[model samples]
Target: MLKEKVYAADGDVHPDQQRIYGRGTELMDAEELVSLHVHDGKCILDLYLRKSKEISVLVIGMHGTRHKVAVDIFSTIKQLKKHLYWENNFCLEGKVLMFNGIHLDDSATFSNYNIDDKSVLYALEIPENHMNIKIRISTRDITSVFLSKSETIKNLKLMIRQHTFIPVDQQELTLHDTVLEDNKTLFEYFQDQEDGQILTLSLIHHIRISLTVCINMFKSSDYVVQSVSLLGSDTIEMLTQIVYQRVFILPKQQQLKKNGQILEHSKTLSKSNLTNGDIIFVDILPLCKITINLGEGHKPITVEILPNDTISEVKDHIQKESGILMNNRCLLHEGAVLEDHKSVDDYDIKDGSILFLSQRPPELVTLTFQRTSGEVSELKFNPRDPVSVQSTIQNIIKGENESASKSHVYECKQF
Candidate 1:
């Protein structure tokens, strides 16, 4: 009797060892033998038998999953040859059962085997198509009017033309490896039959160009432009340019003061240079307070502090106190979820700091009512019946009719 259990390398009485112990029985008589062993922390079975004089078969199966594999076998006289072939070809270093009749190859001295299981039998379940990328383009600020309908490549060229002094002749665009001619326009490149119709515009330049056009052009138009960001290199450059140009402005001279003295004068003084004579007379400006309207039905709360705290930290603190989580829940800061990694610290959060938090809109409910007039009958309603105010009014009207005038009604509610 063979016991079934998961086997490990720590050295235990397992089915694999049992198969090795029963090798003598296989040698005495060529017959199929089924033996189970736990290999590589999985339950597997080995089958050994002589299939033909030229080949012996060794089959292995994993528990639960129906994975069966076959290998070569060798005679006792050619054990050294078998050992050499097994070592160099099969690479079976573990306690695996080697079949006797399975040859390395048909009529060859070697055997071919794979360690695949039943899991490989299943076909991969993949989505047929991915969601199309939705991009919001602002054409209002663009001086280049053609961009409203321009695909990715045209937009990049337009952006490049707007920012850099680089001449169109000096610019070289490449799709994959083939370098596009300097004179070849982006639209022409896509129009050419040689160039693949599917052109990936680089997104790197997208934000930079968008931002540049946005800053330069005064008007704003909402455009659903296809961003070329999916196009690898060009998009990368655009992104890098945008990020590099994002400037962090420090407080202006008028806003920075310390201990009755302007910070500009203390720039040359060390911390230990404190003296009564160093105190300079200065004019004090009244604190400027501006109330931020938090929309139609929201109350604004103020926090008095230096503008050093990040928006994320403030949101976290607000969440901790109000039992409302940010991000997962809604916390409307300036009409949108804080852009990407942008923090509240970017904006000044002084004494009269105002922020808004909004809950998601409730789901809309739909109700439908169907009425039929008939003979005298008793009206009944389900406990879970969802009747609208209008339906209730109609029901009251129907109930007031005579006994001979009866009607049945059906209503449906959807959320």
Candidate 2:
């Protein structure tokens, strides 16, 4: 670590001055002094013969990269950092240099640890064997790519395919104008350069598609012709949506038809014999699903109902399956009583809605009948029954008229 040279004597000193026993520096070892260069036909010693100062040590970087550097054995660890930082503009600013698994202090000299020429000092934060690189996909995707020096470009492509959803065959990655080869690694590509400048490559992708068909669709006067394009394998269900978006018509109100024949939604465009530029008419018939909860503890049922089905028809379905009487069934949704005359759509009931079913026992209705002689009679009947009170009174009056006629016949014979 000594910057100043040791003087044998001041001016033209005697050889006896160099051999000043027990009066000068301690003692010099024979192997300590290393021949640096031959200058002016004279030998020059770079390291003085003393302690570990004459030994050179190896420096290792992070990521398993190694650099065999010759450094002053007695030099402080901070001084060794200067040589590394200046070498090819490399940085060791935040790296913790460790010697024999112990962190080397900047203030501590190499001699403090009794280091030798075979000793290795490591910059624990520097990358060496393998590195983590960033990849910028053209789809505005940023992904992390991990690789060792031995990993091939094919492995990298596989990893990219897994993360970015881009097929390896479709991907043609390029760094500047250089197209990467699947057989070679990045280390082989940039082996000459100072450890492959922190890899950040831009990935390019190309997508391929086959045939597409354009169709003409009409919904009443709101017509949209040749505005939608689709593949031949597409279903009529997809066309319904395209018609709705183009013509501002609801999909539920749409029924695709060609030449007066209805097109089933499950059938594909090719299966329906539809070709490019074919015109299809849209019919208005919307259907939806409704859930009927048959009271508590009963499994709910789903019925596919059309716009024409009223609340009474819905009850009929429940009655057929649940055996609950039509009159006893009381259907309600969101606290509003369902009317027999009103359709489910009229109640603003959307598709896949739940309706509660509870029982309402029938009540009796009383009918009073008064005769011309001031005689009164009360007749009771269930209003929900098949026969009405008015019908019962009419039957009773017909019997009375017949009896009066018979009484008139008896009076003609005796009175």
Candidate 3:
């Protein structure tokens, strides 16, 4: 096999390793190892063992200088260091050397390199892999973290923990919906994206998400107002209970409603479309106060009533307080008689408005009395009159006659 080789400092060939070929002998140009392809199972040991004797590798240093060094695979790394040199003919002593992204050590050999096979990168790509990543803890907080793209996700988390003072186990790094795995390298996760672009990484903690919720009972009643803190995972029904527990006094079996509909207990707040800093309005029945003028001309009686109450209910309440029967009472507002079957809201009896209440006039019957002398007497009669009708008619007939001798008689007749 024709092995490729280059000089340590210059392109001079090693004396003992050279060969002179005669007729029909093949001579090939030397191949320089400039780049390396990293894979899941490939390692620096595999690359070194694939070549034998002498190998020339082109290394690009941090200062942008090309370095050609000859490595003798047959000798140890400590022994080959004497012949290695860089651009200014600088000796390789105390200089940090890296092959395939691994920092070289005198004690480490090709067979004993300590590194993850997936993290092994080309020598010149070391600088490009050092990325200045930004970690966003919140909208107001952003922390910068310097890490290598060849580093594993677990390693990155460790470095971030040092800068953020957060526990590594509690941290979760995510790009979009994709959660980064600890075994994967940063380069693999963001390989398709461009460099220098701000990569947005979501930093989620293990604790529950906190948010503020505004409870508005004005939809039900204007008196209740409350603010509460809730977890994002909490359900809408849970929030309803917490809010109503403080605002409105509910019965033992009563439950709060939302927008006139019962909230689903199993749906989370986020799932129910209730986001942070959201307002939850409590559904309540509207109430109004009505004042009734009882014709006694004294102070009018005011009573609390619902808009949905029937007109009969209002009259009943008025009757109970004023000793007037509901049927005997008629209520009128603004010259309009209120029907018993209609609701209070239908009559537009707004809050603080006055309604007139008066006893119905009794039906009157006319009485006519005729005397034997052909004289006639007429008198008006009330069905609920306290005196007897006969007495009332006799009295009226007596008044029509000036004297007892000329008394007139009246008889009642149907008209």
Best-fitting candidate, scored by lDDT: 2
Q: Best to worst by lDDT, what's the order?
A: 2, 3, 1
> Please, what are the lDDT tens digits per residue for candidate 1 over residues 71-94?
332233134235435653432232
Scored by lDDT, model 1 comes in at: 0.33
Residues 124-195 of candidate 3 have per-residue lDDT tens digits of 332454554667654423344445678898987886664445566666788886879889998998776554
Encode model 2's per-residue lDDT on 88-177: one tens digit a residue: 355777566766544455654566455677788777663465544556654332444445667787878787665456667656567775
Give candidate 1's TM-score: 0.19
lDDT of each: 0.33, 0.60, 0.55
Q: Where in model 3 is the C-alpha error above 4 Å? A: 1-216, 220-246, 249-282, 319-327, 361-415
lDDT measured at residue 104 in model 1 versus the true structure, 0 to 100: 19
Best-to-worst TM-score order: 3, 2, 1
Better of 1 and 3 by lDDT: 3
Leading candidate by TM-score: 3
